[model samples]
Target: MKKLYLLLVAVLAIGTATMAQSKKALQTAVIKTPTVQCDMCKKRIEAFLDKEDGVASAVVDYKRKTTKVSFYTDRTNIENIKTAIANVGYDADDVTANEETYNRLPKCCKKPEDGGGMKKQ
Candidate 1:
C-alpha cells in the first residue's frame, strides 16, 4: 500500500505539471498595416495569419488599416506574427512586406506609393 500511495502521488504531480505547461495564455495584439487598402487585402492578411501555427484568429480592418491577431504566446511572439503579416504582402507595424510578395499583390491591393492605383481594379 505504501508503493501504491507513492505511485499515486507521482502521477498527480506529473499531471499537474502537464496541465501547467499546457495552460499558455492566449494574447491579442493590434498591428497597423498602413498599406492595406481594400477588402481583398484584408482577406489575404487574415487568411495568412490564421494559417500560421500559433495564431488563433486574425481580423483586418481596411478602413482603420489595422489587424487584430489572437495567438498563443507560448508558441509565437509578436515579431514573428508581424513577419508573417509582411510575408502575406502587407506591412505590419515596422516590418516591411517581402518585396517579391508585395510586387505580386493585385494592383488594387498595393499602395499608391508602389504605383498601384487606389482606383478600382
Candidate 2:
C-alpha cells in the first residue's frame, strides 16, 4: 500500500512537470538550392544537416533544386540553417556557399561554371 501510494505521487509530480513545460514550436522551410548538381550534392547537404542542432529533418530534392527542412524554432532559425548548408559547400537560398569550403569540394560537386556536373552519357 505504501509503495503504491509513493508511485502514484511520483507519477503525478512527473505529469505536472511535463504539463508545465510548453511544447517547442516546430517550423518547416523550403530553401532554394540551385547549385546542387547531383545525388552527391543531395547526400552531402542532407548528411550535414542531419547532425545540426534543432534540425529534425532535411530533405533535398537535387533535381528540383530545393531543400525542405523541419526544425525547432527555439533551438535554431532559418538563417542559421542556411549557413549550415553553406558550410557544407552548397548555396542555401540567399546564403551563398562558403568560399573556402566550396573550393575544397570534389570536382563532381562543384558548380557547373566551375566544371562540376554529371557527365553526359
Candidate 3:
C-alpha cells in the first residue's frame, strides 16, 4: 500500500510539472497597417489573423490603421504573424504586403499608392 501511494505521488508531481511547463502566456502586439483604408480592410485583416495558428484574437481599428493581435508565443512568433498579415495583402509594420495579393484586394482595401484605393462610401 505504501509503495502504491508513493508511485501515485510521483505520477502526480510529474503531471503537475508537465502541465506547468506547457502553460504559455499569451503575448500581444500592435502592428501598423498604413495601407488599411476602410472597414473592409479592418475586417479582412482581423478575420484572417484570427484563423492563424497560435493567434488568440485580432482586432483592427480602421481609424487608427493598426491591428492588435494576441497570440501564444510557443506556437508562433511576431515575425511569423507579420508575415501572415503581409501574405493576406496587408502590411504589418516593416513587412510589405505581397504585391500579387495586394493587387487582388478590393478597391477600397488597396493603398492609395496602388491607384487611389480609398472609397468614401
Candidate 4:
C-alpha cells in the first residue's frame, strides 16, 4: 500500500510538471487591418491564423479594425503572424496583402480597385 501511494504521487507530480512545461504563454499584440469591414473578413482572418502552428489565439474586433493575437514566441514571431494575415487578403500593419491573394478574395471581400465593389482601403 505504501509503495502504491508513493507511485501515484510521483505520477501526479510528473503529469503536473509536463503540463506546465507544455503550455507557453506569450504577450499579446494587436495588428490593424484596413479591409476588416464585416463578419466574413473576421472569420477568414481568424480561421487562417488559428491553423498556424505558433498562434495561441486570435480575436478580431471589426469595429476597431484590429486583430489581437497571442502567439508562442519560440515557434513564431510578429512578422510571421503578420505575413500569415496578409496572405489571406487582408493588410496587416504596414505590409499589404499580395495582389494575387487579394484578387482571389470573394466579390464582397475584394477591395474597390479590384472591381468587386468593396470599399477602398
Most accurate candidate by lDDT? 2
For model 2, name the residue pairs that clash.
none
Q: Candidate 1: misplaced stretches above 4 Å?
A: 1-24
Better of 2 and 3 by lDDT: 2
Cα lDDT tens digits, model 2, 1-121, are: 9999999999999998776553446789999998898899999999999999999999999889999999988899999999999999999999999999999998988888999987879
What's the lDDT for all of these models?
Answer: 0.89, 0.92, 0.87, 0.85
For candidate 4, the 10 contiguous residues with the lowest summed lDDT are: 111-120
Q: What is the lDDT of candidate 1?
A: 0.89
Clashing pairs in 1: none
**Distance from true position, residue 16, model 3, in Å?**
6.0
RMSD of each: 3.1, 3.0, 2.6, 3.3
For candidate 1, write residues 1-121 as lDDT tens digits: 9999999999999999888876656888999999999889988998888789989989999999999998888899999999999998888999999999999999989989777745843
lDDT of 3 by residue, 84-114 (tens): 9999998889999999999899887877876
Ranking by lDDT: 2, 1, 3, 4
Candidate 4 clashes: the total is 0
Candidate 4, residues 1-121, lDDT tens digits: the string is 9999999999999999877765754658999987776778889999999999889999998779899999988789999999999999888999898778887888877665665543557
Ranking by TM-score: 2, 3, 1, 4
Give stretches of model 3 more than 4 Å off: 1-23
Please provide TM-scores, in order, for all candidate models, with all chains considered together.
0.79, 0.82, 0.79, 0.74
